[model samples]
Target: MKKNLLWLVVFCFSISAFGQAPKHTFKLGESDFLLDGKPFQIISGELHYPRVPKEAWRERMKMAKAMGLNTIGTYVFWNLHEPQKGKFDFSGNNNIAEFVKIAQQEGLWVILRPSPYVCAEWEFGGYPYWLQNEKGLVVRSTEKQYLEEYKKYIIEVGKQLAPLQINHGGNIIMVQVENEYGSYAADKNYLDINRKMFIEAGFDGLLYTCDPAADVKDGHLAGLLPAVNGIDNPAKIRKLVNENHDGKGPYFIAEWYPAWFDWWGTAHHTVPAEQYTKKLDSVLAAGISINMYMFHGGTTRDFMNGANYKDISPYEPQTSSYDYDAPLNEAGNATEKFRQFRSVIEKHLPAGQSLPAIPAAKPSMAIAPFKLNEQVALFNMLPQAVKNATPLTFEDLKQDYGYVLYRTTIKGGKQGELQLKQLRDYAIIFINQKRAGILDRRLNQNTLSLTLPEGDVQLDIFVENMGRVNFGKYLLENKKGITEQVTFAGTEVKNWSMYGFPFKNINSYTTKPSAIQGNGPTLQKGTFKINTVADTYLDMTDWGKGVVWVNGHNLGKYWAIGPQQTLYIPKEWLKKGNNDVAVLELLKNDQQILKAIDQPILNTLKKINVE
Candidate 1:
C-alpha cells in the first residue's frame, strides 16, 4: 500500500512538470521582459528559418543563441509558404512548425513577425509575384482585392502558428501585425484588417506592429502593442514608445540595421563592427528588447531574387547572394562583426545568465573542375506545331520561370536593322545557328543589325526571365517573353516557334558527345572534370551573355561587363569529381571557353554607364 502511494505521487509530479508551459509575456513600461509576471530582459536576433536551408536552420539558430540571444525572431515569408495564389507549401524548409519546435527545444523563445510585407530586401518585399498578376492588386494598401488576398494569407498562416502562441502552451511570444505600414502609407483600414485577421485565425497572443519612429502614429493599430524599428537613438525610442504606446513599458528595437543589402552592380557593402557594437551597447544599456535586422543573411536562390527601383535610374536587380554583411554571413558562418556584437551583448546580460559556446563552423572542401560534353541544338528540339502560330507569352504555354526559346526562318538575308519590339529584358539573336548579335533591355537597346544568309535562313532567339520586376508602380509591366511586337527590318515576322524552357527540367536534356555539332543556332556540349572542391567562379567573360548551370543548379546570369561577372559557386555545391556544367550562351563567339577561379562575389566586369 505504501509503494502504490509513492508511485502515484511520482506520477503526479511528472505530469505537472511536463504539462506546464513556459511562463512568458510582454507588458508595456516593464523595464524587464516579464515571465509569469516577473521581469525579464530579452536579447534577441532575427534570422528567418525559410531563408536558411532546413538542414542548416538549427545550426544557425544555435549560433544565434550562443551569441547571447534568448529569443530567435523570424519573419514568415508569405510568398515562400504560398508561391501560387491558393496552393500552399509547408514542407521542407517551409516548415514553420518544425522551425518553431526546434527553437523551443533549444530553450529559446520565438518572436513571430508574419508580415505580409517583410521587405527584408526579399523579392517584392516578400509579397508573392503571383499577387502582382492579380488584376488591380494594390499591395500594402486597403484595395479590396489586395485586402481579400492578404486576409486569406493571414488566416492560412494563423492556422499553422496561432496555436503555437505563448498563451497556447507554445514558445511564440509576440505576433507582429502588418510590417511598417505607416512608412509607406497611413492606411488605417489595412493595418486594422491585418490585426483582425490574426485574431480571427485565433492568434490570441500579444499583438503588435513595428514601424520607424516617424511613422509610428500611422502604423499603430488599436488593441495591439506598438514597437519601434530602426531606432539607433535609445532616447528617441523611449519617447516614441511613450507617445505611441501611452508612455508605457516593454519597448523594443524591432529591426536594428546591423548591415545593408547589395545590388548587382554595386560594390559589396560593409559597416564597421565598432559602429554596430556601440549602438548595440546603448540599446542594451537602456535595457530595451532588440532584434538585429539579419543575424544571418542567406542566399536568395534561383529566380526568387528581387529588384530595387530609383526614379532617376533604371531598375536594379538584387544579386542571388543576400550576404547583407550581417553578423552572420550568407553561408551561416559567424563574421568578425558577430564576435564583436557577441562580446558587447554578453556585457549587458542581467549578470546571472551566461552564453553558450559557439559551435564549430561548417568545413568546406576544394573541388576540381568538371566538364560536360553533351550538346543538343535548341532549334532542332522545337515541337512540330509552333510553325503556324504567333509567338506566345510564358503564361499562354503554362511556363513559370527560366529561359524560353523563340525560333523562326527568315527568307531574306540579314542586312537591315533588327528590332525586338518590347523585348522583355534580354535576348540573344542567332542567324543560321551562328551567333549574330545581342540585345539587352538594361541598355534599353533592342535593335541590332545582323548579317543574314540568303538560303533557308534560320533565326533563333533565347530569352531569359532574369527575375520578374518585384516592386513599385511599374509592376504591371512585368510579363515575360516578348510582351510587345517583334520587328525585323520593319517587317513583322509571322509564324514563329516558341519553346518554353523553365530550367526546371534541366536534367532531362540528354548529354551527347562534344563533337555532335550542327549548323547555325546549334547547342554545343562539352565536359570538364574536377578532382577536388573549392570555391570558384566560372569566368563567363569569353562567352556572350547567357545562363550557366553547374550540377543542375542555375548559377544565375553571367555577362562580360561591369555587372555580376563571377557567380558565387559555393563549395557546398561542388563535388570532388566529375561535376557537370552546362552553359546556354546565347551569343557565343568562337572564344566560348569557360574558366573557373576561386571567388564567390564578383565586381570587376566592365560597367555600362547607364546615363
Candidate 2:
C-alpha cells in the first residue's frame, strides 16, 4: 500500500512538470500577454529567424533566455516568404512557423512583427525586387497595385500563423501593424488600410504600431496600442505613452539599438559597452519592457543585402554581412557586449527568479581550399537566340536576378562612336565575343569607339543588374537589363537576339572549350584543390570585376575597387573533400591566381588597385 502511494505521488509530480506553459501573460486595458497572467514584464530580445540557421535557432533562443529575457521578438521578412509574386515558401530556413514553435518549446513567448516592409537592412526593405517592374507602383502607399499585392502577402502569411496565436494555444502575444510608418510619411490612410487587412486576415490578437516616440501621433494606429521604438530616455518614454494612451499602461521599447551596422566604404562601427549597459539599466530599473534591436545579428547571406539612399551625390549600398555590431556578432557567438548585458539583466530580475546558465558556444570548423575542376564557358551556354528581338525588361522574361546577353551580327566595320542610349547600371561590350569595352551608368555615359573587322561581325553585350537602387527619390528610376536603345556609330541596332542567364541555372550548363577565337577579353577557367575544409576568403582584389561562387552559393560581387576586398566563405558551407569554386572575371588578359587563407578579414589580395 505504501509502494502504491509513492508511485501515485511520482506520477502526479511528472504531470505537473510537463504540463506547465513556457510563457506568462500580462493584461493591458483589454489586451493580454498571459505569462502566468500576473503582469509579467517581458525583457525581450530581437533576432530574425531567416537570418540565422535553423539548427542554431534553439541555441540563440536559449542565449536570450539565459540573458534574463522572457520573450523572443522576430520580424517576418516578406521577400523571403514570397520570393515570387503569388508563390509562397515556408520550408527550409524560411520556415517561420517552425521557428515560432521552437521558441515556444524553449519556454519563451514571441512578439511577431510581420512587416510587409521590415527595414531590417534587407533588400528592398523586405519588398520583392520584382515589384519594381509594375508601372507607377508606389510602395507603402494607397496605390491599388501595391495594396493588392501587400494584402495578398499579409493574407498568405496570416494563413500560416493565425492559428498559432495565444488565443489558439500558441505563444504569439502581439503582432505589429506596418513598422514605423509615421517617420517616413504622414499617411494615416495607408496605416489604417494595413491594420484593417491584418484584421481581415484573422489575426485576432492585440495589434500595435511602433515608431519613434515623436512620430507616434502620426504613425500610431487608432484604437490599437502604440509602442515607442529607439527612445533612450525612460521618463520621456513614460510621458509619451501616458499622453498618447490616456493616463496609465505598460511602456515598451520595441527596438532598442544595442549596436550599429557598417557599410562597405565606412569604418567598422562599435558602440562603447559601458554606455550601452548604463542605458539598458535605466530602462530595466523603470520596470519597463524592452527588446534589443538585435540581441544577435546574423549574416545577410547571398545577394540579400540592401542599399541606403543619400540625398547627396554618391549612393552607397549596404554590405552582405548584417553584423550590426550587436551583443552577438554575425556568426552567432556572444560578444563582450553579450556578457555585460546579461549581468545587468540578472541584477534587475525579480528575487528568486534566477536566469538560466548560458550554454557553451557551438564548435566551428576550419575549412581548407578547394579547386573548381569542371569548367563551363559562359559564351557556350547561350540559349537559342530570340531573332529580331525587342528590348525586354526582367519582368518580360519572368526572370529575377543575374546576367543577360544580347547578341547580334553587324554588316560593316563601325568607326564612329557607339553609344548605349540607356545602359542600366553596368554592361560589357564584346565584338565577335571578344572584349570591346565597358559602359558604366554610374558615370552616366555609355559612349565608346571600337574598330570592328568587317563581314558578319558578331556583337555580344553582357549586362548585370548590380542590385536595384533600393532607397531615395531615385528609387523610381531603378530598372535593369538594357533600359535604353543600343546604337552602332549613332545608328540604332534593331535586329538582335537576347538571352537571359540567371546565375541559379549555372549548374545546368555543360562543359565546353573556353577558347577565344576572336578577341576582347577572353573567358578563362581554372581550378584549385583543397584536401581539408576551413573558413577562408577568396582574394578578389587582383581580378577586375565579377561574381564568384563556391559550391553553387553566390559569394557576392567582388571588384578591385577600394572597399570590399575579400568575400566571406563560412566554414559550415565548405566540405572536407573537393569543393568547387568559379569566377567570372569581366576584365581579362591578366595573370589570375586566387589564394585562400584561414581568416576572412586579413586574407585579401596583396595588390590593391583603385584605378
Candidate 3:
C-alpha cells in the first residue's frame, strides 16, 4: 500500500502544484476534472480537420463556439497524414496544428482524440493502404510490424502537437489512445502498449480510453480513466465508467451521438433536434460532461471516402457528404436543429455566461446544366498493359483507389460462364469490346454468362474500387478490385494483360471526337465559366454511377440513384473564368449534362437495384 500512497502523493501534488500559474493543470480527480484546481466541465463537439476545408476552418470553429460549445474534440486521421507509408504530408490541408491553433484563437478548449486507428467511417479505418503490402503485417493488434509502424506514426504526430498539451499551457487537455478497439478485440497487452506509446510520444496531458459501455472492461486500461460512447442512460454509462476506473468519477460521455451516418444505398439519418436535445439536457443536468458526437459533419471528398462491407450487406460505400444531419448543414448553414440545440445549451450554461449569436449562412447559387460535349472512351486511354498470368489486386500494384482492368483472349469461343472468385467490389464484363454484363458485389454477383463471336475474342473486365471497408474485423481483407483469379466455367483463364487506373496520379487526360463504343465506360468533359467563383454543389441527379472532377480537382463520385447526387464544390477549388469538368461514367444512361446548384441533394435516396 506504500507504493499506492506514493502515487497518490504524486497525483495530488501534480494537481495542486501544476494548477498554479499560466501553465494550467488538467487533472482527473475522484469525481471531477480539476482545471486550474477547480471542477471543470468540457462542453465539446466532434469535428474533423480533413473533412472541413482549410479555408473554412475558422468559420466552422466560429460556428462551434456560437453553439455554446467550449471544447472541440477532433481525431487525427492516420491514413491522411501518411497516405503513401513513410512518406508523410503534414503541410497545407494535412496540417492538424493549424486547425488546433485556430480553435484556440476562437476561445475554445480542445480535446485531442488522436485515434491512429480511428474508425470514423473513414477509409480503411484511417490505416494507410500501404500497410497491407508490409510482409506479415496485421493492423490493430499486438503484431510486431503493426506496433513498430504505429509507433513511428504516433511519434510523427507527437512532434507536431506535444508542446500544445494543456500542461504546456495549450488548449489540448485530453488525448485518447486507440479508438473503439474493444469492439474488435480483447487484447489487454495491445491496450497497455498503446497507453505506453502515447506517453512515450510526449503527450503529457490526461490520457483516456473510450469504448461502448458494454465493452469497457476489455478496452479500458488500468490507472487511466475510461469513457463511454453511444450511451443514453446516463446512470448506466456512469456506472460502467466508475466500475472500470475503480469507482472514480469524472463521468464523461466521449461520443453521445446525436446523429447517424449514411451508406451508399441507404437512407440518410436524422433525429428531430427536440429528441436529442432533451437527452443532452438530462445528461448535463445530472452534472455529467458530454461531447456532441458531431456538431457539424462535413464532406468526405474524393477517394478518401471509405466503405462498410464488401460482398456483404449490399457493399455499403459511405457517401461523400458525411453531413451526419448535424446542427450545421453540409454548406455550413445553421439549421433548425442548431437553434434548438443552442437553446438547450443556453439552458445548461454556467450562471452569468452567455452564448454568441449564430453566424449568417454563406451564399449559394445555381447554374444552368452544362453539356459534356467532349468525350473519351475507356478503351482509347489504355496504357501498355502489365502482362500477368492472373488478375492482381489494387495492393499488388501499390494502387490504393480507382479502377483496374484485366483482359485476355478466348481461344475457341466466348460463350460460357465467366466466374470471378473473391471479387472485391464492382466489375463490368466485355467480350470482343462489347458490353456483356455487370458483376456487382452488392448483390453477391460473381458470374457473367455471355456469347461472343468465334475466333480470338478479346475478353475484358474493368473493376472499380467502390471503397475499402472502414470498420469491422473484416478490415484485414479490404484489398480493392478483383482479389483472385477469373475462371471460364470450370477452367482458369491464363495469359492476361492487366491495367491499373489509379486516377489520382493522372495529370492530363485527352478527349477526342469519338463515338460511344460497345456500351463501355466513357470519360466526358465539359467547360463552365465563372466571373467570381463561389461555393456550390454540382448536381449529378441525372447521371449514372461515376466520379466527377472540376478543373482537375476530384469532386468525388455520383449516381442518379440518389441519397447524394450533388457534390460540394468548395470555392477554394474554383477560379475566375473558364473551368474544366470531367465525368467518368461507368454505366451511362441519361446523365449527359452537369448542373451547378445552390444547394446539396444529400437526402435524396432513390431506389436502385444493383442486381
Q: Candidate 2 vs candidate 3: which has greater TM-score?
A: 3
Task: Give the runs in model 1 whose Cα sits over 4 Å from its true position.
Answer: 1-23, 30-33, 383-392, 408-422, 449-459, 475-477, 488-496, 516-599, 602-611
Worst 10 residues of 1 by lDDT: 602-611
Question: Per-residue lDDT of 1-611 in model 2, one digit per residue for the tens?
Answer: 99999998887774453343323443564222335556567788888887776777887888888877888899888878888878899998899989998998988888999968877777667778778767778887899999999988998888778766765567888899988887777788888898899988867777888998779988886677788998878899878777777666578889998787755555556787788898999888877889898887776665676666555644455555566777776666667888899999989988888978777654444333433334445676577655555566665666666777887877765586777776665678887776777776654558888788978888888887665555444545656777777887877887778887776734555554444344333234445555655455676656676667777766666655425566666556677655666676666434346666443341122334322
TM-score of each: 0.83, 0.83, 0.93
Best by TM-score: 3
Best by lDDT: 3
Estimate, for each residue in 507-602, the C-alpha lDDT of model 1 and write its tens digit. Answer: 766646555344323344455666776556676645555567778776666655534566656665677656767776544423345667654444
Candidate 3, clashing residue pairs?
563-604
TM-score of 1: 0.83
**Per-residue lDDT for 166-188 in model 3, tens only?**
88667898999888878888888
Q: lDDT: which is higher, 1 or 3?
A: 3
What overall lDDT, based on C-alpha atoms, would model 2 receive against the true structure? 0.72
**Which ten residues in a row are the worst by lDDT in model 2?**
602-611
Error of 3 at 415 (Å): 2.9
Query: What local lDDT does model 1 show for residue 500?
Result: 74
Alpha carbon lDDT of each predicted model = 0.72, 0.72, 0.83
